[model samples]
Target: MSEDTNATDDRLRLLIERIERLEEEKKGIADDIRDVYMEAKAVGYDPKIMRQIVRLRKMKPDDRSEQDMLLDTYKNALGMA
Candidate 1:
């Protein structure tokens, strides 16, 4: 291969390796989060609700309030609120 081709190949390989490493790290972080939830469950905390709270906390406050309003509207429409 030409030098330019070789360089391009090397760069591509490095990018793939970085992505693979990041994927492994992501998996490990997910496992750690799962363990924390399990521990919370053992101590009597509700993991599902905790996950929901975590998700909500990650959202913008205005977006979350809008979602809450929509959910409440839907529930009230269904007479389930």
Candidate 2:
């Protein structure tokens, strides 16, 4: 209709296209990470534990220690320590 409307439509289309491209890239990266985990499993490594370790590594050391302490406290309370 108007030039302003056309501009707005073009900008919206560009934004959507950019997001779609980024989503595709994210999926590709996730697949690559999955492949690496599969390779680790094939070589006898435990993927579940590996994932936990990766998650822990991303946390601060103090936070990790606090979490471990809380886990131990809960375990001791349950008499499963």
Candidate 3:
């Protein structure tokens, strides 16, 4: 085989291996997230809202302020504000 072909094949192999490793890591992280949700539910906390709260907490302060404004708007619309 030519050097060019060998180089291309090596690149393809490396890309495939990297993708496979990332996929496996993703699955493990997903399973861990699911386990955390189950544990939260067992402890009487709503997992869905807990997840949303965690996500919001990770946002920048400016982004969180915007989210808070929207939430307040929603509450006012529902006459709960």
Model 1, 1-81: lDDT tens digits are: 899999999999999999999999999999999999999999999999999999999999999999999999999999998
**What is the TM-score of each predicted model, taking all chains together?**
0.95, 0.95, 0.83
Q: Spell out the clash pairs found in candidate 3.
A: none
Clashing pairs in 1: none
Candidate 1 residue-wise lDDT at 38: 99
- What C-alpha lDDT does candidate 3 achieve relative to the native structure? 0.96
**Any runs in candidate 3 off by more than 4 Å, and if so which?**
77-80
lDDT of each: 0.99, 1.00, 0.96
Ranking by lDDT: 2, 1, 3
Q: Residues 1-81, candidate 2, lDDT per residue (tens digit)?
A: 999999999999999999999999999999999999999999999999999999999999999999999999999999998
Candidate with better lDDT, 1 vs 2 = 2
Per-residue lDDT of candidate 3, residues 1-81 (tens digit): 999999999999999999999999999999999999999999999999998899988999999999899999999999998
Over the full model, what C-alpha lDDT does candidate 2 score relative to the true structure? 1.00
TM-score of 3: 0.83
